[model samples]
Target: MSWVPVAVSLGFAGLTVLACCSFKVFLGVRRFGRELERTKRRLGPKHAALRDELHDLPEPRAARSPGDGVPSV
Candidate 1:
């Protein structure tokens, strides 16, 4: 019946909405962290294999030529 009561109710509603959204964001972050950990665990072995394979590959050497700077058309 008073403006004061209406303002208080509106403020409470806003706070409730904010609290709900914050909770949702927290859940989302937690889920993302868990999924990230799972993905890393799944890829760990393959990642190591790739690293070992890469290590055994030939190393790159800079190409040097007697006339390297000169273009031969």
Candidate 2:
């Protein structure tokens, strides 16, 4: 039973390492989310302007018949 303490200590060390890695992953994801939000905010006005410009464009004229431009006899 003397090896039980050594096993317990190793288990604790493994758990500590897993917890640290999980915390670091959490921090990285949080930072990525913040960057995405910042980029959205920066580009929001340009996106709106482009949408408005697209809406303001005049529609295409209707297609003409093949002989529509010919003069009558």
Candidate 3:
């Protein structure tokens, strides 16, 4: 019936809620990290190959042209 007990109960309730929320957030972060690692591993070689192919393509003539009305100098 006293204010002290009421305040203590409210504080305990707030702490319990915070603990549960923190635990859920921790689990979500762990799961996301694992998924990101998996995705990076799966894409690594494919991305490298694509980058190589892109590099092998011939350069565009327009991109190399100078003073051709394309804001060159």
RMSD of each: 2.8, 7.0, 4.3
TM-score of each: 0.80, 0.74, 0.79
lDDT of 2 at 54: 95
Clashing pairs in 1: none
Candidate 2: global Cα-lDDT? 0.98
Residue ranges of candidate 2 with Cα displaced over 4 Å? 60-73
On the 0 to 100 scale, the lDDT of residue 48 in model 1 is: 100
Worst 10 residues of 1 by lDDT: 64-73
For residue 14, model 1's alpha carbon misses the true position, in angstroms, by: 0.4
For candidate 2, what is the total of clashing residue pairs? 0
Report the number of the highest-TM-score candidate.
1
lDDT score at residue 28, model 3, on the 0-100 scale: 100
Across 1-73, the per-residue lDDT of candidate 1 in tens digits comes to: 6999999999999999999999999999999999999999999999999999999999987889778687867
Cα lDDT tens digits for candidate 3, 11-35: 9999999999999999999999999
Clashes of each: 0, 0, 0
lDDT score, candidate 3, position 20: 100
Q: Worst lDDT window (10 residues) for model 3?
A: 64-73
